[model samples]
Target: MKFATQLIHGGPAVDPEYGSLCHPLYHSSTFAQQSMDHFGRFDYARSGNPTREALEEAIASLEGGSTGLAFASGMAAISSTFLLFSPGDHLVVCEDVYGGTFRALSTLFARWGLTVTFVDATDISAIGAAILPHTKAIYLETPSNPLIKITDLRQAAALAKRHGLLTIVDNTFMTPYLQRPLELGCDIVLHSGTKFLNGHSDVVCGFAVTADPEVGKRLQFIQNAFGAVLGPQDSWLVLRGLKTLKVRMEQSQSAAGQIVQWLESQQCVTKVYYPGLPSHPGFQVHREQASGAGAVLSFELESYILTKRLLEGVKLCAFAVSLGGVESILSYPARMSHASMPAEEREARGIKDTLVRLSVGLEDPADLMADLDRVLNG
Candidate 1:
């Protein structure tokens, strides 16, 4: 089946017991067994739920993975996935990864003895140079958060394979509909399902998917042990949201292209970072690996004054922290996503005071342009 069809029919879509079109929510914290001699597939909520199971199946199928694990939030998914490594092991991660991930690794994981080296993943040489004898994995976020820097996933995965390291990618910015990293030789695919997968912004969720059964089993163990699983109702909501993935992504990507063009022409704008633009550093590499440029883009203003004005003055786009909702969201990395990082470190990673990231939504491109113009020109 094609992507659109798979969105609707993939996984355990039909209610096997009730014959309902949508998967029914199984809210019980524990399941009953017919006999003590034989345990059922699910004994406790922490281990699994029928509702969450359906959503997990959908994500795994969408990403072409053998297994999927759902979590309460994106951070939970990421932190738990990192648990797959031992304390003495090291990891090479994209320097511009999402702030929450950076914080977790630099503070929590580091304290636990999981060392990491941050590198500019856009340069394959940088990734290779960072590898050490203790390195166990390479974590990446392509069209990386706030900066929109793209990494060549296939090349990176190949390099990891040579070093016998796991290749894990955060596929939040480019949902499986746009880019399937597992197919590009990545060992694991991760997502902040709160973003595009749940598109409506009503639920907070995350997923870890893997094509290798062994990796899947390891993640499943961590998920169960950590107990950060998504609740049944949120799983149902995300399942409902998955049906419209194709249409929502198409509309948002179209709007983003229009907005990128307008931002490039604005006098107050100093630079725009979007894979869709030909001038973007990873334009060709991104095009070769992914089906679309995705809906998020970041731009730099002429000054911090202009940046503050535009972020505070946008009338149509919400000045908010989260993105990938039905409404456009404008966020400041220095104060929002990357605020946890030290000033010098964030600057070194190119997340500047004048940089603003935008998640274009389902709104009409013309209205969005007019609203942005009013804010920037006013």
Candidate 2:
């Protein structure tokens, strides 16, 4: 079936109990059982809920995974997955990974004795060199965080399999609509549903998807034990937002392409980092692995003065903390996204002080470009 059709009909068609088109929300904390000898499928809301189950099944179908586990937030999902490894185990991660993940690894994971080696994952050889005998997994973010560097998912996942290590890819930026890592041989795909999947920005939720039943069982156990499962209301919100994902992604990507072209002509903008552009180093590789370039892009200004002006002067695209909504967002990476990293570490990873990231919205391309021009060149 086509991806667009899958978005609407991939999971449950309607409310099975009521025959209603929309899935019914079960708001009760606990389900009553007439007999203690045999209990219902879902005894507690944390363990399971009808509303949450529907959303989970939808995400699993969209990502081509056998199971999907939801969490309170993106970080909670990531942290719980990391806990799957024992204390002595090691992991090799991308150098420019999201700041929140980096903070968790450097602080909490470090204290727990789970070591991680940071590498330039764009170079597969670098990943190989960093792996240790105890390395249990390879974790990465393609079109990585603020720098927007691309990692070859196919090659990386293959490398992990050869080493008997699990491969985990964060699919928040691309979403399942643009990229399905499990289909590309990845063991796990993670998403911050708060961003694109919950396109309205009204919900904060996360998902961990896998095709392997054993891994799914383990994740389900951790989700229940950790007790960070997403609420039924937020789960319904993400499920509803996911229905229009295809259209929203297409419109946002089209506007991003136009904005990339306009940014190249401006003297104040030093460089544009977007996989869709022909000049991008990963353009060909990205095309081979993913269906689209996605809507998020990062750029650098020639100087701090110009960067500050563009971020502060923009009226249309709000200078904000997060990305992937109907409204455009202009974020300062040095402060907003990658601020958890130390200044020196951020500099080494090429997240300079003048760099800013943009998450294009469904706004008209001409209007978005004009707003940028007024700020950068006025």
Candidate 3:
């Protein structure tokens, strides 16, 4: 089936028992067994639920993966996945990963003895050079957080294969609809469902999916043991949100392209980072792998004064931290998404004080541009 069809019909579409169009929400914490000798598939809510299961199946089918695990939040999914490895093991991660992921690794995981090496993943050679004897995985965030840097996923996956390391891609920016990293040879795909997957900004959830059954089993074990599973209601919300993934992405991406063009023409703008732009360094490589440039872009202002004005003056676009919603969101990387990173380190990684990230939404292009203009030029 095509992607759009799969979004609505890929998983268990109807309530099997009642024949309802929407899946039924099984809210019980425990289930009764017909006999002690034989038990049902779901014994406890922590292990699974019918509502969450349907959402998980949908995500697995959408990403073309064998298994899908859902969690309470994006960090829960990532932290649970990290539990797959031992304490002495090391990991090579993209330099500009999400701030929450970096904090978890640098503080929590580091204390637990899981070392990490951060490198610019755009250079496949840097990934190879960073590998050590104990390195177990390569964690990446293409069209990376706030900055919009694109990494060559296929090449990086191949390089990881040679070194016998797991290739994990955070598919948050480019959802499964735009870029299926598993299809590009990545071992696992991760997502912050709160963003594009839910799209409504009402639910906080995450997912971890893998095409390899053995890896799936390992993650499933960790998910069950950690007890960070998504609730049935949130799962149902995400399932409803999945139905409109294709349409929402199409509209948002179209608006982003128009906004990027306008930002490039503005006098206050210094540099714009978007994979859709031909002048962007990774434009060709991104085009080779993904279907679209996604709905997010970043730009640098002439000065911090202009940046602050734009952030505070915007009337239509929301001045917020999170993105990928129906309403446009404007964020400051230095203070919002990447604020956890130290000042010197953030600058070294190219997240500047004047840099602003915008997640274009389903807003009309003309209105958005006018709102931006009043704030930027007024």
Candidate 4:
């Protein structure tokens, strides 16, 4: 089926209990067994929920993966994926990753004996040099969080395959519509469904899809064991949001292109980091794999005070954390999202206090541009 068609009708034919066209919420925490032997695919809410299952099935199909797991939040999903490895295992991660993921690995996972090596994932040679004999996997975010660095998925997959390592990609930025990592040979794909997949800020959710059935099964075990599965209501809301993902993304991307060009022309802006810009270092590499430049873009202001002014001055864009909402949202990585990382660490990766990331929304580009111009020029 076409991507758009699949987004709306990828899972079950109808709601199991109500026979409704839409997937119904299964709110019960536990299920009853007909006999001493458990029957019918569900035992408890943590293990399974019909609504959550339906959403997972949809994501799995959409991502071309064997199975899918949904989580309470994106970090929970990422942490669960990392759980596949044990103590003493090494992981090579992109330097400019999402702040929460950085905190999870450097602070939490490091304490558990997981050694992490940061590298410029965009440079394949750097990634190769960083990999240790104990390296179990490579975790990366393409068109990376604040800097917009693009990693070559196929190249990384080939390298991982040669060394018997796993390749896990955070596909939250592009969503399944723009890129399907499984087809690129990535072992697993992760998403902050709170972003593009959910397309609205109301739901905080995460999802993982694996091309390998065995890997999928192992992830399922971890999900059930860890019990961070997303609730039924959130799952249903995600399903609803996903229905309009194609349209929402199309409009948002269109606006982002315009915004990036405008930002580049502004005197208050030092540099604009967007894969859509032809001058961007990651532009060609990103175009080689993904279909379009995603909506999220980051830029550096002339100064921290200017950054604060631009953020506070914007009337239309939301001055908030997180991305991929119907309303445009702005975030300061240094203070809001990646504040946990130390100043030196963040600087080494190209994320600065003056960096401002924008999640372009569905609003008219003209209005959005006018508001931004007023803020910057005023």
Point to the candidate with the largest lDDT: 1
Instruction: Show where candidate 4 strays beyond 4 Å.
Output: 16-19
Q: Please write out the lDDT profile of model 2 over residues 1-378, one tens digit for every residue.
A: 898888888866876677987778788889999888999898999999989999999999999999899999999999999989999999999999999999999999999999999999999999999999999999999888987788999999999999999999999999998889999999999988889999987888889998797999999999999999999889888878998999999999989988998889888889999999999998988899899999999999999998999999998898998899999999998998888999999999999999999999988989988888887778
lDDT of 3 by residue, 106-131 (tens): 99999999999999999999999999
- Can you write out model 1's per-residue Cα lDDT over 21-78, one digit (the tens) per residue? 9888799999999988999999999999989999999999999999999999999999
| Per-model TM-score on C-alpha atoms | 0.99, 0.98, 0.99, 0.98
User: Against the true structure, candidate 2 has what lDDT?
Assistant: 0.92
Candidate 3 deviant stretches above 4 angstroms: none
C-alpha displacement of 262 in model 3, angstroms?
A: 0.6
Q: Ten-residue segment with the worst summed lDDT in candidate 3?
A: 8-17
Instruction: Give candidate 3's total backbone clashes.
Output: 0
Candidate 2 structure, TM-score to reference: 0.98
As for lDDT, the candidate ahead, 2 or 3, is: 3
